[model samples]
Target: MSAAATDHEHALVYPDEPIYSRITAGKLAMWLFLLSDGFSFSGLLLSYGILRGSSQVWGCTTEAIAKTFGCIEEPALGINFTALLTFLLICSSVTMVLSHASMVEGDRKGALKWLGLTVAGGALFLVGQCWEYWGLFGLFGPHHGLIHEGLKFGATHYATTFYCVTGFHGLHVLTGVLYLSAVWIGTAMGKTDANTLEVAGLFWHFVDLVWILVFTFIYLIPN
Candidate 1:
């Protein structure tokens, strides 16, 4: 074949710069994954809203006291506690972005520091979630049964939806923590790159965004 024809054929097969050239393959993959995950979370939140709106009562309980005393009925979900958790996640997102900035600037130590802070924030958020769960379901010591007999999971669809939605988001936070830890280790060992850290940041930020929706829909909205 003539050289000109060969070049033309090559250009047809692959443009000089593909449409996705601006984003690394890995980052593109992460974006696609986040898009699909966003859909899943939207569906869950939508279902929660539907169930919540239809339910007659969505009862909540106060913090767990001694086993003898147990928990008392409250006005709504522990909004104060959840609001704190939401703040933690938002702060972690800031640290996550700082980590990415440090990585881009070739500051390995700074990146690691920010990433560690982000991981800590995620861990704290998870701890808060667990505490809230324990308060609601009495999953741990002393309070072994549901906090309120009337608010039992089987008794109401609200209870079931609440747990399912929040539990799913909690699982995402847990997974994001693990994912960040791995990236941090790789960054420390000089194996991870800016793109990797940025992709991780995308996932972390998505988790934060989802929680905001959950907090608004599940906690702030009145039953």
Candidate 2:
């Protein structure tokens, strides 16, 4: 065979690496994890929607005496408070991206600064969530004046789905915060690379994205 023909055959048999070869294995693994996690979150939120739709009433109103009059025949999940939590989470995503950017720029201090802010944002979000859950379930002490008595867990499908969905998301936020913290510590100790930071950022961003969906479907939607 001619040299040109042999070379052509070799080229065809040994193609270049796939496009995804540009992505580090760690990054690729993170994407795969996020994709599967996304499906789980989607299933939970879809189930919430179905349950809410089937229910005749899905909300409650409080009387002046701090008692729940009963389910309000509509969907309401404390939009104002949850909206604030959503905002915090979105802002954390911004910080996460900034942290990655700083790492790429070889500014370890800047990266640490942004990562610290991101962790704080996640921690704040968890605090707000715990407060919300406490109010709903009266877990720690006497029921707060702001929450109605009828809003305990297992009271209705609304309560069940609300806690299950938001509680799941809250767990993710907590995990992300702890994960970011570990990354930050590793970076500080010079044990972590930019790729590791980027991978952590991917998880943080996914957590934020899922919260936006949860906030919209669970908190903002009306029956």
Candidate 3:
């Protein structure tokens, strides 16, 4: 047999690395990417915390935040809409994980179903954020120090810090939703199989982790 023929036969018999090994390479790359992205998010959150903690005016306790926002509209600890938003985001994370699992299990239909539910939850979360923005901008009064639109709010520092931090986080969430939408489209096109699902799942999980921190620091944490 010719040398070239033997080489060709070897290539055909020993098809490169197995799919599982290739999947591992993809997973490693994803983890590295996520690690860098995680650092970026951590920096943002840390900056927010440092600035927020330094602000004497925003030092109001959770009770004060609720009062200022008219959370209860009466007395009591009041039902904070931010808390509800947190819940929706957390629930969406669960649905996203389920979607990933369905895809891995070769249940494309199940994955689609869960993906739709996740998208709905993400929509609700975005709407809740809009309302929160309105509450801070409108009811809080530009002067109260949440929206520094035109120096109308007395403390530009406070409003600027609050808006910038929360708005940045919101944008991240929006981006994550878009990423999920793309994954869903790819799955629909039969372009994304189990391996693709795993990579996308990692991204989704990272988003959820960031949101958990944001919810705790921005809303649940007192002052």
Top-TM-score structure, candidate number: 2
Candidate 3 per-residue lDDT, tens place, 1-223, comes to 9999998874453224665443456677989999998888888888877877786545332566647754321111113666787678778878888988898888998988887778788777886676555444455433222222222222344444556666777787787788778888888888786666677768767776777787677656664
**RMSD per model, one decimal:** 7.1, 7.9, 7.4
lDDT of 2 at 144: 44
Cα-based RMSD of candidate 2: 7.9
Model-by-model lDDT, in order? 0.81, 0.80, 0.67
Error in Å for residue 69 of model 2: 11
Error of 3 at 192 (Å): 0.8
Q: Which stretches of candidate 1 lie over 4 Å from their true place?
A: 1-18, 60-75, 135-151
Best by lDDT: 1
Candidate 2, residue 80: the lDDT equals: 80
Tell me the spans in candidate 3 whose CA falls farther than 4 Å from its real position.
1-23, 59-79, 135-154
Instruction: Name the weakest run of 10 consecutive residues (lDDT summed) in model 1.
Output: 62-71
Looking at model 1, the pairs that clash are none
Clashing pairs in 2: none
Clashes of each: 0, 0, 2
